[model samples]
Target: MLARMTGALRFSPAEIAGFAILAAVVFLVLPLALDTFRLNLAGKYLTYAFVAVGLVLCWGAGGILSLGQGVFFGLGGYCMAMFLKLEASTPAATRIQSTPGIPDFMDWNQLTALPWWWEPFHSLAFSLVAVVAVPVALAWIIGLAMFRRRVGGVYFAIITQSLAAILTILVIGQQGFTGGVNGITDLRTLLGWDIRTDAAKEILYFVNGALLFACLLLARFILKSKLGRVLVAMRDQEDRVRFSGYDVAQFKMFIFCAGAAFAGVGGAMFTLQVGFMSPTLVGIVPSIEMVIFCAVGGRLSILGAVYGTLLVNWAKTTFSESFPELWLLGLGALFIGVVMAFPNGLAGLYADHVEPRIRALLAWLGVRGAMPAPVAGGAAREMAPARSVAGGRQSGRSLQARGGASPEPGP
Candidate 1:
């Protein structure tokens, strides 16, 4: 019974504690600490967390480096934007424009009729579905073609980057249909409810945080599953995994599509929080920045990715506001610092330096005996004596009492 209970717990004690602390921080600490405006900013940062978490699965586990995730983000944001725009463009609301039933930008560009593509977005249901489906479908096609051909590594990254550049150009060049270089703006409401209110912003923050936690749980399950092991196996030893009766291409494609779906949901959330979507976010720079968020957070750790996104964006906002000219230099230095000092990111630093000290501190505080030792895969390990079990027998009772030097084995 004891062994079964121990084996049933998938996470180590430290990991479970870490997650509990994170939940408290997001759901309790931040709200109590910040004003409404500041909390809204945090909500905006959480939107990026969605993208960073997705990258953890695709790049960290599957070893697929896609430089165009912003494309999917933009797709989802645009989908949501279209719905808001249509809602705001009701004939009664647009009576002053030459085209009384269409978007203001279309009227400005001398477009008398709504574009065929824009027509579908008029339905809230279709728009909601498109927010996720469009990006996944695009990723599916791209993954199918590239993975089937065994195209990966730097070549795959370059192709994705090119796609991002092309999509940005197309959105900019198609003025009447895509709102030109300005992208989508002036989004008024969602489903007849004003999203610009302070109360709405506060509520949306919780919603975003809850959704992020849900995604983290889903990603955690995937990472602990057999398929996740297959992904890592393919990452380190693709030929061996392929020859072991596994369909390597299928796993790669599935992960890539899943990542796209995650990014799409994030983009929609960003549109809601920020009240706009733009071509600027769909270009090469934003996509690469998303990668940096994952890298700085420890790409393999989902929670770390969330923190990374928040920290980096918070730094960006702070420095850009106070020292505008120095913001770019500071950001570049951050990227360099993370890569040079802690290649595995903030999570890596915590695991390597901070966690051991924490354990020692807890032990000194007389709480160590109640906690399990750190997991085996971590950098350090501590052994503890076995305790009494059912029927008064010591757990793992062995040669220790029989005068042998060998200690009880650690889990």
Candidate 2:
């Protein structure tokens, strides 16, 4: 049982190395290298990495492509935003407004009082729960409705994309409640502690990094389990898995909800790090872009998703600053190029080309366990030339025994 448990929890050496390197970069290197401002930007980018990691599990491993991850992200962000917004809108602070206790946007729109639904968010604990639960609940509903009916592939993708568009429109239309296109801005505090300070931002960045690592470990655990194998089987052969007595729809629903939960956590972190949550993030374009981040990082690679999110967002910031009008086009072209030239994304390239060379170098340097065990038939192939030489020597001995002239061995 101990052996089985150990096996179940075992991660590959490469994966272990990846986790360590990622931790070092996020926790140690970036904090030391970047200023608070740049670090905060990185924290924002890491928020999106949550969604990308979910996509790696949902789309990469399970073959369930969702383009409405932004919806979950928005829900989580809004949940946290509501809490912060409420905390900021103290009766004393908003005494000049039409509604003394309501949010400023509600006051601007001539709102009379805080809505009933917003009451629960007043509690930090409840708000945090909602941040995860709301998105997961939505995912559960969607998965039950669609997966039960066997809806998937391009159709599912389109449905998710449509949901993103619809949610964006709804948020904009409900301006009085949802803050419209301006989003929930000017967030001030968490538990009465001002969050806008540079020191606060730095703390939040580290917190975000820690949360991200937790998510990474959770994802790693899921992928390493039997459930992960089942997910892969379902991805490649759904009917086979279903026929083998597994409830395919339940598995799909579970993974879909898990992805939504991850997105929700990311969204909440985004709000804390960026000081706002907006309808712009809950739209079709951002949703698709999130998918692109996953794809570019190698949808199958959890760590790669983080790297991809950082790289793409970095490029986006750089390009948008220099060529505001052409950045979108450049992004499209980058995605196209990646899809065409590197279908498996950066992770695939590393695995096929880079990792092998690194392993070879390590092995040459006499590092133990640097090289993987040889594959079946590999040993036989390697020994073929030696076997041929041995056969030649045996033939020479036989000829000498038969009284024939022995062949001279040449150097």
Candidate 3:
């Protein structure tokens, strides 16, 4: 039993407990506290949480800081938006348009027919598949090209940032097909069910939470696996990892693609919850903001990433609402503070200070299972031999001094 316990204890119980608590809060407490409108807003923020979680793995563990996650996010979002836009732009609904069967923005821009790129999105199944698939495929190409060529560090970041800028400019330039700066808006339904209703928002909120937790679990599983350790090893010592006969580039590629997938799914959820996908969200600023979410949460901690995203976004919304002009200044100060003070983020602070204090308090209060049980067999073996030897020595000294034979032990 003790051996089995030791084996099972290889996995960290503290991490599991943290995830369980996070699940409870996300699934129970928040839904109960926030109203429909606020919950829907939470769902929107949760979409960004998805991006943050991915960043935790890619940037924190894999040490790949992608400044173009918004591109993947936008691709996934636009795929979903295209499907929704098509459904919303049916002939009957667009009877007033010169192009009766096209999106409003396209019609307004003098497009007489739906573009070839927009046609595939008419199928809901294809749209759903493309949401994750498109972003992942793009990431695969980029990762393969960059990692194989040994392009990383600040250079890789700059390249990704440039990609984001280019994509944003393209979106804004191609107003007819891409919806320009206004973006794909006025999304109405999903499979004939109205997503604009309060009940739908409530349902979507729960669904978003479920998906977020699922992603969290997937991330945890990966992090606990051998591959996760390899990622960390690679991040810290890329040359050593490569010298150890491991295909380091493949590992980097896989993580990059995984991060892109997460961001893509998040973008789809964002479109569903918020009813819009815009070029504003598909640019360098939003990409950097996503990184900040992970940074603020503690990049190494997955649960911290989620909380960090929610906290930062909440602060952003509140500050923007209250003191619109000071919001940027406040954000700048926050970034500076996080960099200078909490380099490891909230998780590091909790792990270093709060968790140890909690354990001490629990111990003082005589709480059971405050920590995992110690491995018993080795300690017991060492102590038992010492006791036997000490007893023999003491008995020998006493018997010699007394000049009497020792009695046999009782059964």
Instruction: Name the top TM-score candidate.
Output: 2
Tell how far residue 351 is off in model 3, in angstroms: 0.6
Assess every candidate by TM-score: 0.88, 0.89, 0.88
Which lDDT tens digits does candidate 3 get at residues 288-382? Answer: 99988888887877888898999999999988999999988887788788878876677666655676677778778998674543421111111
The ten-residue window of minimal lDDT in model 3 covers 376-385
- Residue 72: error of model 1 in Å? 1.1
Shift of residue 221 alpha carbon in model 3, Å: 1.0
Per-residue accuracy of model 2 over 215-238 as CA lDDT, tens digit each: 988987887678887987787668
Model 1 alpha-carbon drift over 4 Å, by segment: 1-11, 368-370, 374-411
Leading candidate by lDDT? 2
Candidate 3 Cα outliers beyond 4 Å, as residue runs: 1-12, 373-411
Model 3 residue 6 lDDT?
53
How displaced is residue 369 in candidate 3, in Å?
A: 3.1
Q: After superposition, how far is residue 250 of candidate 3 from its true place, in Å?
A: 0.7
